[model samples]
Target: MPAVSDLTSHIGYLLRMVSNAVSQEFARKVADEGVTVAEWAMLRSLYGGDGIAPSALAGKMGMTKGAISKLAERLLDKGLIERTGNPGDMRGHSLSLSPMGAKKVPVLAGLADENDATFFSVLSGEEQDRLRGLLHMLIDKSGLSTMPVD
Candidate 1:
């Protein structure tokens, strides 16, 4: 072989290292609040509206209908979301945040804010902004539009 690049020299490896650390810590923090990151994302998405159809939610979250249905069932069982039948369609329904979920959303959002702050506390403000810009550039260039729920 002429030359082999070191694993540490790969940007993907470096990104994954940091990403895992950030994601794991955030997952633990959210877990304490009785919700996973994916559930939180779904709740947050519903926060902007009164309700949304399952198909619409699946499209918005870039998830399959089956995945959304599973998540919705879990949230419903947990009493964090409510379902209402559509007026025109007897079989159609929409999901919305329950009063409990609506209340928990702000608290969970605070945790997310704190998590970001603590994780990036090592970087200077300017450095953090630059890093975000670079990441956005990469996302935009790659046309990565799917929401990262895992």
Candidate 2:
């Protein structure tokens, strides 16, 4: 007889199950705010400060420059972000969150916090902390620096 493994027995399968549930729920929550998960990530990144170059933003998000430009266009259309041009450099530009975007960051952040709490409510505080620590350890071990926006 040959040996076979159950689909549920794989660690990746388990991780994917949990990840999908968490991400889907978060996506829905943010969608209600008229922003996709990726847009939320961009907004959150820009929340730190303004005048971030598209290339720099792409690097920080671990995405391609083209992807950043696309996202910027979407955000600009939504009136959530604005583009700034350099005086000396005609082609040089940067992105910053608009007034509305700045106000929405905290609201979206609250939703994120609530979603996480609701989803992980089954775990104790200590358990949640331990889980996060373990996940961080795994991320570091695997050299995974890209932000999970999808």
RMSD of each: 1.2, 1.0
Models 1 onward score TM values of 0.94, 0.96
Report the Cα lDDT for candidate 2. 0.95
Off by over 4 Å in 2: none
Per-residue lDDT for 1-150 in model 2, tens only?
A: 899999999999999999999999999999999999999999999996957989999999999999899899999999999999988889999999999999999999999999999889999999999999999999999989788888
Q: Model 1: residues >4 Å from true position, as ranges? A: none
Clashing pairs in 2: none
**What lDDT score belongs to each candidate, Candidate 1 first?**
0.94, 0.95
Per-residue lDDT of 25 in model 2: 96
RMSD of 1: 1.2
